[model samples]
Target: MKKLTYLFIALFSLSLLTTSCREEKTASEKVEEAIEDTGDAIEDAADDVEDEVEDITDDNK
Candidate 1:
């Protein structure tokens, strides 16, 4: 029973330590991520436009 209590305490402490050690993004990191996301969105939009144009052209042909 004592060993089981110690084991539970150790696991709880380890969980606390892991949860508290999370990495936070800096302002510049956030800006960079936003820029990348915007770029990806733009690229996806462009691809979708291109696909629509091709479909329209194919239907016309």
Candidate 2:
């Protein structure tokens, strides 16, 4: 019974150590999300600029 208990404990500890590495969402994910947000913002700014240009052209005509 004691040998089986020791074996179980060792296996459990090994399992815990194996599962501890490779955690979720470090800096790369945040940077990627920030980049995606920046792209969307730039696209929105471009659309606004295009609308303004069209408005100015219509006014001129």
TM-score of each: 0.71, 0.59
What is the RMSD of candidate 1?
3.6
Deviation from native of the Cα of residue 11 in model 2, angstroms: 32
Candidate 1 residue pairs in clash (backbone atoms < 3 Å):
none
- Candidate 1, poorest ten consecutive residues by summed lDDT: 13-22
The lowest-lDDT stretch of 10 consecutive residues in candidate 2 is 17-26
For residue 54, what is the lDDT in candidate 1?
Answer: 100
- Residue 5 in model 2: shift from native, Å? 29
Q: What CA RMSD would you report for each candidate?
A: 3.6, 6.0
Which candidate's lDDT is highest? 1
Encode model 1's per-residue lDDT on 1-61: one tens digit a residue.
Answer: 9999999999999998888656999999999999999999999999999999999999999
- Candidate 1: deviation at residue 22, Å? 1.0
Cα TM-score of candidate 1: 0.71
